[model samples]
Target chain A: MADAPAAERAATGRAAAAPSRPRRLGRRILGGAGRVAAALPAALVLLFLAAPMAVLAISSLNATASLAFPPSSLSLRWYAEVLGSQEWAVSLRLSGLLVLLVVATTAALGTLAAYAVARGDFPGRRAVAGFALSPLMVPEIIIALSLLYYFQGLGLVNTIAGLWLAHSVVALPFVVRTVMVSAQNLDPTLERAAASLGAGRLRVFWTVTLPLLRPGILAGAVFAAVTSLGEVAVTALVSGANTTTVPVRIFSAVQFELDPSVAAISTLLMLASVLVMVVVDRFTHLSEAL
Target chain B: MTSPDPLRPAPAPAAGPAAHVVIEELAAGYEGTRVLDVPELTIRRGEFLSILGPSGCGKTTLLNALAGFVRPSRGRISVDGADVTDVPPHRRGLGLVFQNYALFPHLTVAGNVAYGLKVRRVERAERRERVAEALRLVGLEGYADRRPRQLSGGQQQRVAVARALATRPAVLLLDEPLSNLDAKLRREMRVELRELQQRLGITMVFVTHDQEEALSLSDRIAVLNGGRVEQLDTPERVYRAPASRFVAEFVGAANILDGVADGGGVLRIGDTVLRTGLPGPERGRPAVLALRPERVRLHTAAAEPASADAGSGGAASGVLGYRAFVGDAWHSEVHLAGGATLSARTHAEPPPLGSEVTARWSAEDVIDLTTAPAEEAR
Candidate 1:
């Protein structure tokens, strides 16, 4: 390990001192081969990730109402149609409002739960943490089926309030996991030092604990917003005719008519997800949030 | 066997320095095993006392209890004659500086120092003045705008101290605040901290496992062993006349010799006899003797010139093992009879290796530790 750098320096010096034509060509070829070898897997992964999005974007631009790629002519007619239709507009507005409510509820509830589970030493602390993260492990189909029966029993079917609650429950685990990471990183001694400096419990929480956990809370809010915006399974089960989200509308549209407007709306949702990610990364490194 | 007399001191007179904090029958533990049990301990006003002990000896636990961070299961803690055992840490009106220098990273240096004053509802004008005063006290005047991460370790330590002092509490508790700094910085900060404590005349309770730090900085050192105070005395007495075997070995290097007391101020080891000057523990009981290396004087056997001076005190004859210069003094190891070894530190040159020499010490310097209970291995 210690001599590898020295060996590399010696090799570089040899190359620099003797830059003959044939040797230089051979070295260039070797370097290009090594670079290609290193980048092949990464390029494949990127291609795999972007293939579906590319097809969706391309099909959304078809002039007619057909979800066909490589259309006879490229035009923004479907984008206009999706934006102008009242049914699609209603779903967009409903999804937007639901995203806002889910972000607010999950951010508040997740941060509180994270602090308690990570820092508190009560009897069932581990169990509470496990329960908070259990949604991430259980299948979304199960959650959707359960919420269907549960909300029906509560007379919450077809209500926007029910969809809001459903989205929050689905998005809460991501927020909790991110905020828990930040809470565990928090220095307990800082709180102790604050208390020793004569700050009461409430004062310490407001002044020290809350400010230190801001990055995690913001990251959690972003996660909640993105998760709620993309959620479909739970929303499908609980949402009614008055509260059909864009994803639900697109799901039904692709099932029967195969509308190009569904492709347009799906492309827009993907764009919104990317935009939220960029903004969140600019504020707090998204890698740290997970 | 009887306990040493000087290890325990009488209660202070009414005219002595007033007691600032009193701990009575205090016993604190975690998970049902008591780690600290102080029957009676008092911190006088404006005195620097160090709770000195090795790790796991409950010194930090004692400091936490005093700072109101750890509640004693049995007994009371009183400050200024008011019972505060049940008081929360924030309401205890005491300052504790953590070893890590737990300055809030989000706050600037000035903001960190002003935290206490702000919590007390001090007005903006006065709060600024106190923050400035504290920064100036720790020689951090121009560092008000810099965040804590920008400061060096020494500077951060000063900020922690300044933050603790800004509140003007009744006492300041420092938990090895200088242990994290480099060696030279630690020494410099030690002197600066002593000067600061003396200048302010505020009572300070310093907790440290470093014996040199405790010796140099404390007015009185409380030597703890196995969750008990073995000896609490001036640094000089604790070093010169350790109260127990644990104190002698822990405080400094000591040549502990096992011998049988003859009850006439004499002890016999192997086939050699020495005058201890201290009262013997029992007539025929085995006794442990503690003698500091610095006190043991090495005399060349050929000289034979110390008859009058060395006749009344402890004496032993041994072959010189080796001698090495240790910057300030020459340290020599003497191999005695019966496979025992003795160490001596002296300024003069020691005899050559394998040469016979007589190690002598004054009778008054001998410490007898036979009565101390056998310390459990922690």
Candidate 2:
């Protein structure tokens, strides 16, 4: 340590006496080459992901006749149009209502299922867990078609109840998967300790198990809400004219005409998702919960 | 700290040996692999009984069964002459302290101690008073507001014990509660636990793998092996007169020497006949003599006594193979000329390597370790 400064000065003197220009250039090039190569894929991915949102926000503010990015004149005309239209208003209300129901239903059912899989020692517990999570990995198109046929056979197609149920099914696995992560982290001995202290089954669950699972419940609720609001395939198959959700309305509208109001709606939905994520992160440490 | 808890002014439940806990034909297993089987066992009131064994010896399983956490497949467990075999853990009124403490992370020390009372809907005033008393009993009077994470390891252990004791349950069950603390803290807590048990005079069923803890704390120790009790006796008796080979080896460091039984309470080993307190097995039967290393004395060859009485448990000449100074005692491995190595523990350093020395033990100090045929209960 005492000779550190002398060693550093000798190295510096040697560097000064060498051909520094070519070495410096080569070093810069090598470092820059690695950086450039690493940044290329990330840059491309960022652009691809952000471009559509950029277009959506810009076009939504356009005062021109067509939906265009970098509008000739900017205004809030599309926002007013979407918010004022009867169809958009009703569809957005329905989607909001359906998402609330889905979040509640999925959070409760998924948490219970997760608790069973995480804590229970019954036979086929692994099978039940895998089955509960399979819906997430299954293709949406298959699930939508299957639901279409199944709901049709049950005569429940095109009903508001049916739409809510479909969204719950689509969002169930996200809730279960996150909640299970938290539930598995819980020490089972805590429950046993509570029982030893004379707490019965219900009391133990309410006082011990439920309090420990709060963060997981909050994270799962946020994920389920966002996933349910954005879901379109199953809603399209199960919802009717009276039960059309915002995403289903946007799907049909895009097929018929390019509307600036769609961009406005997309921007609003994006803002809402961002807000929910922020709230969830602040309260539950969403990263840790997941 | 040595004074008894101020909370208990009297023995409210008749302190002397009143109720006898009886277990008959108990068996428990997981996934059809038998973990514990006890033919019959009785725990007397006001006595601390420790189930001592290595891990996987069904010690914890037996404790769980007694606490009603695990159901015995084919047995009856009774407390105070009442059958509690079918009762759940909560209804059985047996307190359990988990190995990890298992304090409710969300609750304060006071709240944790108040849990059992709160569950039973005890009057709030009484609950507060009891919590205070429980905390005081464990010497944590002002720590009610602190979270379990805020306390030291020893304090957290005290809180766990306080929580279990708050209910004044019939029998307290503890599962390796001191294993989480450092060596010094574990020793301190062991003393505290023993004092509390004596002061309260409540029957306690403790499960641990620490032989020293069991020897120091328990009124009686049950040495378990392979899902059965190998020996059950008072600490002194178990240490002094181990009923089987497992008990002798597991409870302490013992040197087992093969010998032939020479009838009339003596063992013939390598031209030396050891006088024994217990009767020997069949004549000339190959028997084992378990001698505590500390009980055997190592003397230099020059100091050896006359040779005629050497084989009469008085002495045996051997070359000292190795010597180690372990702070309080010198541990030595002495090689007998008959090719048997006997360990000797002494207060002084052993003679130089390969030097001739005599290893000797009082016949009364050596135990006759005859392992009974283990019952195939499984």
Candidate 3:
């Protein structure tokens, strides 16, 4: 009986010292369950966003003549056809030119407008800021319809300039919002300090304020470029026969034929967007820019 | 005084000496609300002047007005006899150090220091030399390649000072430059800044809310209150012989005792009468006395009567209510017989709480002000 009590006491001592075993096991199980629950939604979102691009890429390489899932054979015939087409090449060049113009114009106008809104304190400053940012609130179709009517009145329809103008209007708000946030986060004292150190007003702005706003400018420019590259609605409304951008071309192609050529073009557009995003992420922190 | 002779070559432009900065009747406001009203202030060359005041006291406004950041409504600001009131901040030939250091974060320390010279269109070689010299003066010789964020707070402030000094402006304005530093670093930087100012022999105006900082660093301190200069004098004179009750109380903690002058070179506090150095008024006139805590001595009941001839001594004693163990001293609050409280700071450890102690101060140590009362002084 003495040995039995001693053995029970020893067991109790072991249990007391190792009390965290059950708690740790419970915590591990709960943590694993939580991880699974969190990952399931993320996995579902990723598949939802990525499945279309995956299917497009796969269809572009199929040897068959029609759209098919799990192709029996893979081939690059559609890519070769896409690369060899004069219309596709012209549309690609047009889109590139539009992207360049839109990105440059939007970045410049957005940075200037953001500076005025964030730093300047003139009368009706708030109202002016609201008007400048109103593009984001309006529906793109309304913007396209208005631009269509306005350009038609101006006799600028079917020209690249009209398309560029419409795209710039749509892309300007993104640049303005991004750069404005960046300008707002900057320290105003730095400019004042530069001025106090014998720097003229222009020099102070250029040397101090502009350098700090570079990240915002880069972020806004990249977003504007990507958006302008893939813009369809406004481009379709204003673009003439000779000024059809890639998205307009793709839209026309889809109406006539649902083939591997469209998938190839889409895959190329997606690749370009991912490339721009990666470059933007490398140069400036996207989170901070947002 | 004789009028100057008009034909004597304009008296050689009064070649005796010149005040580096002369501010006359300066008045400034923000958005139509008056903030600063300094009647006259002249800062001589090579002097360190401190503008000491609490928040909203207009010290910073005064500095800003002098720096041309705030245009005075009615005043003349002259730097080295040249009127700069209408000039812009960049043209005032003055350097300003902000409270946050304001170092440009995107630029390296060398770039920040070289910015002023570049703006002035100085020769590239001379600019490089001056930048290096300025960095060396601040003891940041090798930190030229580092950005402001990579440096510590003190190092950043030094870079700011270096950047400001690179242009050799006529005056330097430091607005709470050391307020962002820790307490120990603040003390060390105060010494370093004072030494630098003395070595450079440039007129400097330092603004601070800390009395210790102002007293320790300034050649002359302007104590401001309610948008007016309360008193401007040396630290010793300001402390020992404050012109008003506000100056006395603001510069250091004072024990304000209200009394009535009783026509006999004596002041009456309740039923006890004490001799005063201030001239006695007609009977029943109100007066306020400022007593420093260090001047008030605490003694046991047995020893109180012996010091009666020096000042008023009461047989009644009160309990030592609170005791704090300050290093090298003991600060105790004692409740007196008349329900009034007085603090005593002694070199020796005070008696424990609840012990009876008598508080005594000499008549000469109490400063008398003709102000309304202590509550109205501030």
Say which candidate scores most in lDDT: 1
Candidate 2 global lDDT: 0.85
Compute the TM-score of each model's chain A versus the native chain A and list the values.
0.88, 0.85, 0.90
lDDT of 3 by residue, A1-290 (tens): 33643564586765343336776588679789999999999999999998988988898888877887877898888888988999999999989998999999999999999988999989998997888889889988898999999999998899888888999999998899888998999888788788798777888878888889988998899889878987888888888899999988989998898888888888888888888788778876775676
What would the per-residue lDDT of candidate 2 be over residues B24-129, giving only the tens digit for each residue? Answer: 8899999899998999788888779899999999999998888888888888898888899998987888889989999999899999999999998999999999
- Flag clash pairs in model 2: none
Candidate 1 lDDT over A1-290, as tens digits, reads: 45644565687765343356886688779889999999999999999998988988998888877655677788898888889999999999999999989998998999999999999989999999999988899999899999999999999989999998888888999889888989999999999999999999999999999888878888888878887887888888888888899888988888898868888888899898888788878876676656
List residue ranges in candidate 1 displaced over 4 A.
Answer: A1-35, A62-74, B1-17, B262-266, B270-283, B302-306, B310-312, B322-324, B349-353, B371-378
**Which runs of model 3 end up more than 4 angstroms from their true locations?**
A1-20, B1-18, B262-282, B305-317, B371-378
True lDDT of residue A193, candidate 1: 98
Once model 1 is optimally superposed onto the true structure by TM-score, how far is the C-alpha of residue A181 displaced, in angstroms? 1.7
Give candidate 1's error at residue A41 in angstroms.
1.5
Once model 1 is optimally superposed onto the true structure by TM-score, how far is the C-alpha of residue A75 displaced, in angstroms?
3.7
- Interface RMSD, all candidates in order, equals 0.6, 0.8, 0.9
Q: What is the lDDT of residue B66 in candidate 1?
A: 87
Q: RMSD to native for every prediction?
A: 4.5, 6.1, 6.7
For candidate 1, the docking band is medium
